[model samples]
Target chain A: MHAIQQQYWAVRDYLSPVLKESKFKEHGRITPEEFVAAGDFLSYKFPVWTWEKGDASKARDYLPAEKQYLVTRGVPCLRRATSLAYTDADEDAERLLSFGDSSGTADEWVETHAGRGATVDSAANLGEIDDIPDLDGDGLASAMADVSIVSETGATVGETPDLDDIPDMEEEGLEDGEDEATMAPVVPKAGGVIDASQIGVANGNLLQVRTYDVMITYDKYYQTPRIWLLGYDENRTPLTPSQIFQDISADHALKTVTIEAFPHSSTLQAASVHPCKHASVMKKVIERMNAGVVEEQLAARKNSGKHQDKDGKKKWGFGRKGAKEEGVKSPVEEEEVEGMRVDFYLVVFLKFIASIVPTIEVDSTTAF
Target chain B: MPVVQFAPFASLVQPGFWHELTRMKIDVLRLSEDAITVNGSYSVGRSIRDRETGHDIALGCNLTVGEDAYQKAPQLSPMSVHTTGIFKNFNTIEDFKAADKAALINDVVSKIWDSIITTKDTSLLTQFLLITFADLKKYQYFYWFAFPAFVSKPAWQISENGWKQADEEIQGHFQLESIYDSLLKTTRSFFLVKEIGGITEVGSIEQYEEFFAGVAPENRVIGFLDPSALPENPGWPLRNLLTFLRAVYPSQTSSVRVLCWRDSERPTAGKPWRSRFGVVSIGEGDPTTKPSAIGWERHPTTNKLSARVADLAPMMDPKRLADQAV
Candidate 1:
């Protein structure tokens, strides 16, 4: 296995602080606007030099006459998406086979935990939040609390970040006559849009589009991530067949070929790459960025230690970047450099999706 | 042509391997660098609850292997089911192992486990079973220590008097975790033989036991003693394995199946084809009275042993087996 295969969660962990937290607000997800706001907030701490893909000279011939300026519009794009979570083929299979119908599972759980009074199905009717007081305080209570607390949060951009403080656990706060066996709060997935109108649209279009239409949904049978590339121009016009076919690389063009006789476009446009190496592209970007940090640290160390300093603590590279007050490097510089690194990572991802997809703009100014 | 249910005709089971496993990580015994192992420690996941016990089992030691394996002997290349053919030879599909067979394995297993008790719906049992059933059979015998069992109540329930006594004994036995540390053993299980006042001696008559022990009697456990050494008398191991199980307990208890496949001459063709067969043995006491006669029936479709895993749940209960009689 390549180094990147193992570094997926590590990279996700490294980028999670600024990119997205797994959950938010009683399972409430961050609105794209809110996610962008949080990204802005993090940018102040670890800023990336983000820019737009606007080079009229390098514009391809397929560019629409109306939206050709998307290249030259200079809309100040930073590679951003509201949220993403990774799952491999095995995990996807186990989850689907084990608990494909979550409602049935919930009914079973409620039946077991609450006995007959309220099933997990009916438990939802009892109230939004009900606390089944954990008498022993051993496993279920603490575990439910842990699951509830992990509501992948990406706060609305410009809004104060509430990522640190998990929403209050609604306890016996349930009114009398309510009995839900204390079902976890239902986290509304998707549908959070960043009103890019606030951020300013390019030309007449929303500079950013947050759409799951282009997601890499894992195919259970194939045991691969079947990437469905959205077929649309920046103007939202669906692309013709030839237009779609033109987007993919010759080597990966086999993805467009139909495997089954189904008339569905899903099989036609989507493709499966080697799952093990998919993350390598992202890892390559991080490696380059990490190297920049090391180089900075080395440069910093060399400048300070013309002579070997007596104190070993001073020579340590960690947290030493941008220690500017005493002319020492500070960690802030490393984060800033990392910011550029992440932006380039995003750029690489866009290029990758572009290679897989025939239509759809990769670099959007608004939060995806 | 059909997926064969191989036999344990040739296998390496270091009866003492389980004595070396623990909870920290997946460990292995470097048995001469090439021979195989048929026993190890398995653990349950953290969030799983036992149906018999209200919490998850701490660690499942003294576990057995080849219980879920069905392969054509150990190979240099791993028998893993991959996604879209990675690290494979570009030309031939010789090394190519598709997910269809794996998916079929899952499909069949799911059909049986469709009726799991809701009370024990947790990660421990489900996760452990998935990994055990899904992962390809590696020749190295790695990860003797699997995952833990999660259930509301453990498999074995203690009586009111035995409850406190069982708790104390569990703490004394595992040695790692005291009962105070939220993590607790599901049950302290042991294999029972005709008791010699708890002396570790081979009883004249074999009996089925659920309790744990160092040297268990043969009726409760069955594995290869050496390479391809099939008893001159056919079905000897199968007959011995089932003597204690079929004599008592439900058919589900006898679900622990062992798979063995070896290269042998064809019955008439004389050309070499993979000869595969399995023994569906149920435990019954010494068959001297019952006449250790085992009947074999052909499966309707494929070449299957009598034990067809249809419409049944996986019997993943931890076990303690009796050693072979000297």
Candidate 2:
């Protein structure tokens, strides 16, 4: 049955229609050429991501040698998904209603776990409270001020032993900074967009930290970028597959996330966020951002009316802010209906992905 | 008081670092296993605390190196300190596995010890070692990262309540910003912090000898851009620094204040940069005797003292890429 399903997928992938330029804006899918262009733009803007070539043995002819896939390593996952405030039913219902109004597909949001985005809202509350006293019962001030004797070790200042004579302190590794002491959870600032600077300094527990090495590959059949994740524990040890699942939202863990062998590597298996619904979701996000663009343009148009063409040279700015007027409603306005540039496709895609995996922190740098 | 146990340095090798190694292997370093100097960096620890679970998450204390690891001089960034390390890429996985890991670490530690006794550049104490074997055919890499620190005779101890937040001592954001800016300009990972007539000052590592002689012992504070986020502990780099201090300082019994200089890489409004101040006492070690070092990274899952593997075939394998492409 698995072999049959694989065959069916292969045939379906081969038969899938190539994304047309017109549908690219409407459907949020792209051709291989467009994928490269978008990848280039993303890498240019955010240097955190860079293109890389796979093994010479598995090289793809469609993409350039140096640009086979994109990767950003050591993306910190400060907390587990469950640690974030759960998406309340009311907020989920509100999101479903808005998604229905925009894309007429509300159930898709519930199915994909993409709508479990309560953390993104909380993430925005970063940087409001600056000096939170280390509420870790061991008071910060008292802990630093108190003095104690070190008579237990029995070694005085001048009569210390040589380094060679010292026993292996590997067992003492536990006492080293991996202290089990906990601090009061941080209450995020009430309202604001997340600042990239604050993303690294947020109130995260040092004991349970995890890091993710992320990979973004263009999915040929789905016509979208697919993300793969390999996580490591605080000690930089690789997290088991089940351990990785703990960081992923429960909604998407068993559903969309699949453990499969990556196409470029032969020996390793990684968890990949399936790209099946990426196109439609990306299309909805693009449209929403474009609507925001239109609203801003409308606001600009209203503001520009105050200045008017006082000099009579038609100094009025219209759609996209820089287009010239040629009487028949500038061609830029027509394009403005599908306003956002294809270069921003990956940015929007990441924003959608962030909602699904709120703790991974890959999108924090790119969101702005 | 408890022994000052340092948080181990976590190695975060960027994929680009491997890609660069691959390129150098094919184009420049074909069967060579010579030691090459590479640059790595660590920033102030950024962690979050969960008040609900009371779980303190250590965001990362990563000694990271990427595509720019091969650069001769660091392009200084405000967020992190660009420290130096040695990289040895073996030709085969067997060579990587069979090699005497202790001897390899000792060799690097010996070099660090030599530099500490001879060089004025205290930055030399921050040296680390990395070994790897890239299986180009399989797109896999077997690697180990070790941050060597000599075992002190009298283990360094954190005096009771020895560490506290230094937001006030440093004055405020303006002074902290100035100090952070100076840190980048000097490019020294470790420095001497002195208070000259109520005005705080930071000096390069070379000045520690003179600074220690001139200042009162109570005011002897050494600062490093701390990589560990945990409040009670310092990062792995401090281990070597402490060892170096014991060798060079004039006093046999030195009670020095340690400033774990931490700040947000990009300071946003309302979020001020903060640091920690701790008092630690180090006893003199026998300068002639070489200390046993510890810093081999543990294997992620097996929890054994073994090398970790990374398979990049899906991204690096050409045939696989082609097959995945439309």
Candidate 3:
């Protein structure tokens, strides 16, 4: 962003009001305490995730000790979203499957590409890989010490590793049975190095997979859980911001994904999914899930040989919108959705996030 | 048979490790840059492996620590072999860069060598060194890890039969459950497995002097809970173990059978857990001569001998701190 804009944001962030009361049920926004509660539930449900007390110097007093943010490591992204057959020719699929209303047209979307005002490969394609001078052990320390590595632009220009020659991990214990678990992505070549005939033939030998260390922190301004991703290539080398963008769905890649500082750690600048519309999307998801629960309960009652007319006056757990066909009447939809505990907010939030980055097999939380 | 090449131990530093280091710098040691003993754990399973390549899908070895890393007595996990490492936090980036890396490596390697001759402590085989510079103000940590492995004149090789997955019959004879139970009960990563008639028994590496005294050279079976997923080669810890073994018994080098113990968290019923057996051949070694060693983790992206930087200012910046609180 522009220097003035960044400065304005810093001032605004510093002056942002603290949310004291919970508006989780009404606006889908949560307080810091509720964020911790949701985070706790997420960690309890998925043991892969754990709460970490970040740098003590930057510790926030509002959050509990040892519970600054949530993190799950080595979340495998087997294939690039663009390389997957399901997503290769399907730009409209991302829109149709979006958790938000589908009424918004593609043209209405304004791309918020990261590093726009910055100097980190602002071009569409990574043209010439910058020769990031190889500094030996001692030189690297002194070299990096002089630079302002904290700035978003400074981080991108720091160490852009050669994307080509992605080292293949040793090949001794490979069994044929794991083929089902691994996906084959068209290995990214150095600037259209391979032609059509050599599409899969040239780079077909090895499976190029990426692993992500996903971090979730509460965005106080947005009052929603914002996710930040630190991705590593197949060889465990840090992926460049552009390389990381390949794994994100194209629709969200241009619009939502932006390079920003991870809250818990100031030194790391990771690609974060913007939380501008998190509450709206979450509100819709909560309603849909509530409706689904009502359907299941209605179906169960019908299968249980219960007479609906006898219990006509009985209050149903859900509202009467979808219940008309089942001949069951209940309270308002708002009351039915109130049953959703705020603790499951993150779990439901991830359900929609799966659409944004479908290639990342991160949300394996018991099918939600 | 193919000559066995050990897969280098890939350093996996959990973010918590850095956080704990930051806490130690601020709360415990303000300006002093002394070497503190820390712990790192790695498991045989949980490796993402490619079916085609005997190599692990990612770099192997998760040398990680958690919040309780610096606890007076850190609790060890049953699934992994916990190894003690030296953590040296430098006061400045210049000091970290100018630090005697070669001397640092030699120091740890000598410790392993000394333990081999004097104490015969097998845990020293996995001794590692971690050097770092934590820029607490900026919240960026520059660190490098070295898992020192002693070099042999003639590297260890697999026998003509090569390494093979132990069959159900061999598994039955060895008693997999007993070994698994023994591993859970002790912190010893290296152990001796002696099968008398049909009963299998597991003992600590410290008892190697007495445990294998009467056993024939051919019957000497050394089993380690290997952290690498590769079936062909064992993890890096085996290097020093073999070196120590060679120093102790140079005559019986060819007769030792190595059982690379690999365990899985979710074991499929009717299917045997991943484990391999191989006969290793190591050349004669002089205890007098200090063996050469090499193992310093490199920056993956830069591919240079560079220290890794973890920026944590977003969580620590005063403005950001005030933003979260107010």
Candidate 4:
């Protein structure tokens, strides 16, 4: 593994304490793959990718077949820290062919590297990379195509191909041969609003999806819900994909903008330890929370009688937790608002708004 | 011996006046050349009667003569000597009236004889009395007037028409006009002497020296004047009495001084007294006569007489004296 990848794992090891101590695992496990994905996502959104790119000699090599076929076409794969599967393919194609298994292939391979037992599955036709289906039905090929294309080129897909007549690819689907129709923009359900009740299995198995489970785990553990772009401004106008990416990229570092869920009242809400400067955003968040739109799932588990002692004995009638419980419904019920759900898209949108907005400092030296 | 000539004043008078004058007893005894002795007595009697009852009583009359009674008596001018006696016993108004008439006749006769025989020029006496009285009345005023003149006039001219002259002239005019009024007034008589020597026997030589050294010219005079009258001389008797009383009693020393000055010439043995005392003299003649006589003495070595008069011209000027004194 490259040094940065090793370093990333080391840092991840350090973060595991905070995650475990915060009962993140009890909420749901965040797999190594997921952790790396989160890191990669943060890196792409910030300048961290530059730090992740180490020595060029350690750059990932591709298979001969992949170099001949997939690279001639256009697709990108991450190469700074070589994936073991890709590295294994250069050493032994037969052993690396295990990645072509039918189900949980990536999961099985990752489990073996982690020194865990793996599940066996039937050998599946490694389908024509271009013919692989997108689970999101977003009309783009499977991510496997990205891996294959990157391996074949032995060069990053974002760079130009040797054949000048060949069509060029844009990081966004803007090139002539880019197949813009296949790269269907996520319309975000036309003003989709996720309420707190939809956070569990009821709302189309939200926790089953890795992204949603990650978001929910983060919400339960850190009381920080991951927010996605809802394709709208505060005035509820749809934003283009370019605008959504631009907004998200610009505010990737800010915690408030990265949270997914919002309160389910009349306004939107996000949480951060640091004070927010944007009065409108803060006010909206506060109004939504006050109006019971942003449901807090752990309100009951958090000692609804806020006066309870550390040992969980009630010291007085409900305080903060009681107020929160009174404002929110149980996780199974809908929030009674038709189009309100504190979901990832809204979390990202709110996060983008929050990051673009400035932070405020008050008499911070004083205890509130 | 020089023939003793007496003016025949006794032959010229009426018999009753002469008889009354001769009836006055006159005893004179000489004790050396400088002293004399005299003794005499007089008495008066009256009858008392009751108006309602016809009761009558007779007062007794007695007289006795003391030895040398007048030996040391203050020397006075002859006009002051007089004597008379009267007696009466009555039971009614007729007798009392007759006795009163006799007493009045005796007093008038004695006074006339006294005026006739004792005429030793009373002018000096009168002037002295008037000036002393004036001084007592207005010494401060006179000092104020004289002081300026004394400062302005020459030292010698101070006695000429300066303060002293001005003082005397002012006094003489006032006296000439007011003498009759002063004499008619039944006032006690007083005498002033400017020079200690003008008195018969005053301070001894040593006493005189001491007195002269201590008493500035402004303070040398001795006399009394009526405290209410201005420009009248205090008589010699009052001056001598004040000096003698001041000496003897020593307590009356603070009484104001009054001096009388006249011509610079001495009085002849038989002439009316002419003298000046404690006054600045202006003439160029001998300074050792009368008013000047006060400072003269016989020189012990040469036996020659000389006068050393105080330069009183300064003191005669109130301003000069005040300046020098201050």
Candidate 5:
């Protein structure tokens, strides 16, 4: 196993007892395929500052010297971990089903389904995965007959199936009835859930149940993660667009981007939608892009001779002399004007997702 | 010694009237050969009568002689009768006729003889004559007799029995003459003449000059000479007599000196005398004195007596007296 995989298991084992005391039910353990898939997702979405072997000095020389190095580096890692923990792909379906059964009620069926392992990606493909083929090719005629009977009984009784019947095919249609009434399917989009269980199979590893009761316990210790992307219009007036897209696109370079997360109780699916991780990476990329854009704008103005004084002096007017001395350059003209030159800007993006599972068991006899 | 007698020598002067009166029925004898008998007499005749019988009353009368009878008698002696016989009146002739004439005559005769003969001795008669003459020299005849009469009565008496007894005893032995002598002695011996001249020796040539020196020339010294001492104008001699009297008997004549000069000059201006002799005489037994007049009288003369003091020294100018040395 990879060293990072071992660390993940250790952290999981350490937190498992605490989670169990808090009534977190785990159906099984996580498969190695899931860990790799989660790692891939984190790597793509939350990249760290990279340097060549000798480039450490170069990068250090290039980047602005700041006192808080960990704040600039380790914060990205932590944010990434937090987001992955809330990802819907990390949910355990069987655990959610068992949770539903222990709850002993059916009124929350729709909410339970929504909170389960189904992601936007899997939800959209519900139509293709709706029909399950039997294990033997006898069409599972008796099991289908029992499922039809249980379905009929569930329609009549509006209650969960018996716990003993859940493994039997008789309770299948009973659970199916509840799913059809509550969970409306979704269409898949890009950058959606990537199934890590499949990776375990391809790697010829024995399949683990992959049940993880990832409870995103929140307290004042964990603050809400939010991203604030500051931009300006052509008039140099500050702009805060309520529409997230507009805020991201309005400025080619974001001036000030920050991400913050609130304290909350959520599943890993909810945490995965947190924008803190995305916000950290996008901040650096946006800074470079904005620096280029502003420099271009400043150059264009210079070329056009738009900013000039009446005395025909080039007016780097942002930090210029006072009106009394038309030609005399003030000290601010060198320091402030030079400093305010568009070196960089930043932009932040954030997403958080939480997965919740509620499992229900319907009694096949109750359907009649 | 054989009694060989010589005839008397006759004087140039004839018997005076006093000699003729004193010689009546009296014999003069020379007791010794050298003795001169110039006969003089003093005859005192008094009539006696029985008041109730209205008849001539006679008692045996005789003349007894003294040795110095004639010489002691003054030339102008006056006769004086002093009667001491008592008479009782019956208020009726029958009652007088009824009385025993022989016994009455004997009684009358013995009493008259006893009264007359009692003063017949020589010394007694001499003293009588001397006293009578001295009195006559000082006062009138009436005063000489009246003074004895006035003084003989008790002048004052105490009403209390005890004090009355004492007064009686005092009167029984009292001698007015001795009292007079004491008064004179007290007066004259220290008689600080309240009068100016009486205070010092005065009326002599020396004292006279001193007195006149104290007077202004315009002022005269009027000497009041007594007329009885005629022809002599006896100023100094009389004053010497008074001094002799005071010296001989200070108490009898000391008061006499002041009484004699009581009305004399007072020593200051506006009076009869000027500051004569400048001597102040104080009346010593002036009831003002014997408790002692020295302090009271001397204080007045030395301090309060105002005198027209004159400078008597020949060398002192009269202006000096007016200069008010005080």
Candidate 6:
């Protein structure tokens, strides 16, 4: 098992008391698998979600807090850390991952090794590391050997980590064997409507899958439903940030968009957070979701038989579970309409976020 | 000397908002799947959502005098429909940061500060008076209002002349009313009234009460006070009327919230600073010269400006008072 996988399990183990101690399961513990599945489901349901890829080889990149966990549990390959999953136009599409600028590269990883009480430069750190009598042969020694190589180049830690054809910061490369020009806007020929079905993403790198479950609750103030996700990959593997960053559409990346908050209620006195440019893609995505098949289906449902109850009451969509409305269509149709407002947004949000992560369906995803 | 200053006004609003928000203790407010907590209590930052249209709106911070900061009641700007979801719906920090720095910070601060209000147990008592600032076409001014937390918000409904579309059935005229109506039931939180315009003067207290019947008597009342209209002594007629109403029905009237906004550069006082518009709050500026004042009033129910004359008459009456005494 990868170190993070073990650590994740360990973390879950630690929370076992809180998870199982309470009289209710809601306060109790869930298996690690359950958490991963929930996180995966949530990543697909919300507009604001990132599939994180933590690099185990770059173990130094793990925060000081997470490092002790990494060391004890053995290292994990967290290549999926903070990444997103995407699918091409295929209905049975394989998920490709798009990674973001995550943690340390080769040098930083090497530096982190040095930071572990080495208190010295390349050779000294190496010498000090060697002083430890229990060098487990080529295992720790092998990974450490890469650090010496990282130190020799010092200047180029310069060669840049082999990005594995990950899209560069410019996001100009096409790894999915598609025409480079396709990356540009498709420029809809039919009015302002975009056929979401036609949109396809490159599988530059396959995203490692994890199982997770979703728990939802409302925010106290915003009155907007906030989705809470939990879970991690089964193998406990993590992804390189570039694997995720490479998949981000040029528009949604930082610098193309921003969310501003006004000081008073006035937009004019608004304060902008993190000075990065941001894209205005949410509305456009919603428009596409709105102009899709869902609207037609809702309209059809409204017209076909389920119009009003015998008492002449307009059928309100919101209701508790097991609520019967003149036996409307079926249990499925009623839920579709009732959850239409939130679900439609989630569906489109799934697609938009997919543009940010690579979509790879490794066997690990299904097996788990 | 004038009491308020402006350079810090840009930043002061956040702390001021937090200060006001600390008083609210809501139980639960669900946007959809997410439940947010404020001041250690479940609360919702109220905004409107249209289920069918997918259109949404949020309460804009009233910039009239920073009245939103003063009364803590915000309303959406006239052009805000276009900018609603990005701030509230962003699920990722990266996505949030990409939207707009100010907006992202605003959103983050709003989210992170939900339950961070300190428990200063000083004034846990419910305050009924609230003053909010607002803006209209070309008007920007203060609004004094009173809507206690115990009153339920009124819902909108349709009456007669209900229009039907295609296969949909037509009910009644789409008149605004509360969804669940019950003037008698007690509410958990205070009701909030959101009016569009800034500030304006009324002919009399009776006319004021009648014209703004949308604001129920149970809720806290706020108004856009125009102290300039008062005579030499100005007799604080509005405050007096509220005090009288409170004396008649102590359960409804508890406290009053006052807000003032004006251009400080006038010959009025101390060296002026730059501001789009300035606000003078109770604890903020120099009260000596700018004078944050409060007075009282009481008269029999037979008075012309009696709240009973208005449509939103309190449940109390002289007969009830006499019966209680007996």
- RMSD per prediction, one decimal? 27.5, 13.9, 11.7, 72.7, 88.4, 30.8
Off by over 4 Å in 6: A1-368, B1-44, B47-176, B179-326
- What tens-digit string does per-residue lDDT give for candidate 3 at A33-64? 99899899777656567787765666766778
lDDT of each: 0.23, 0.61, 0.61, 0.22, 0.20, 0.22
Q: Is the docking of candidate 5 incorrect, acceptable, medium or high quality?
A: incorrect
Worst 10 residues of 2 chain A by lDDT: A143-152
Q: Is candidate 1 or candidate 4 better by lDDT?
A: 1
Q: Mind giving the per-residue lDDT tens digits that candidate 6 earns over A1-368?
A: 23344356436534533221211112112222333333344343321232322222322221231211100011111123222122132212322222122532311100011121122243332222222112223232233233332322352222333322222211111111222211112222222212111111111122122322222221112212222222222221111111222222322322221112121122111111111111123333333333333444466466664533332222222111212232232322553643223323332322333233222111111111
Query: Which candidate model has the greater DockQ, 3 or 6?
Result: 3
lDDT of 1 by residue, A1-368 (tens): 22243245335533443313322221222222332333333233222211111223433232222222111111111111111111242123111111113445321100011111122243342242122222124232233233222212432111223221222211121122311211111211222211221111221221222111232322222222224442332222222222233343332333332111011211122212333333433343334434554555555455654432333233322111211122123442343332222222223333344433312333231111
Range of the 10 consecutive residues with the lowest summed lDDT in candidate 3 chain B: B50-59
Error of 5 at B243 (Å): 99
Q: How displaced is residue B257 in candidate 6, in Å?
A: 16
User: Candidate 2, residues A272-340: lDDT per residue as tens digits?
Assistant: 888888887777666765665555445446565353323212222111122222221232244344355
Evaluation by DockQ, superior candidate among 1 and 5? 1
Q: In every candidate, how many clashes are there?
A: 74, 38, 19, 58, 72, 139
Can you tell me which runs of candidate 4 are displaced by over 4 Å? A1-11, A18-368, B1-326
Candidate with maximal DockQ? 3
Residue A120's C-alpha lDDT in candidate 4?
Answer: 17
Clashes of 3: 19
- State iRMS for model 1: 30.8
Q: What is the TM-score of chain B in candidate 5?
A: 0.16
lDDT of 2 at A30: 80
As for lDDT, the candidate ahead, 4 or 5, is: 4
TM-scores for chain B, listed for all candidates? 0.20, 0.89, 0.89, 0.21, 0.16, 0.17
Model 3, residue B245: C-alpha shift (Å)? 4.8
lDDT of 5 by residue, B60-110 (tens): 111112222344342211121111211222223234324333343334334
Model 4 residue A226 CA deviation (Å) reads 5.7
Which number leads on TM-score? 3
Tens digits of per-residue lDDT for model 5, A158-257? 1322221222111111111211111111212223221121212322221111111111111111111222222211111111111111212111111222
On residues A74-141, what C-alpha lDDT tens digit does candidate 4 reach at each position? 00110101111223322332121122325543312111111100211112211211121122222122
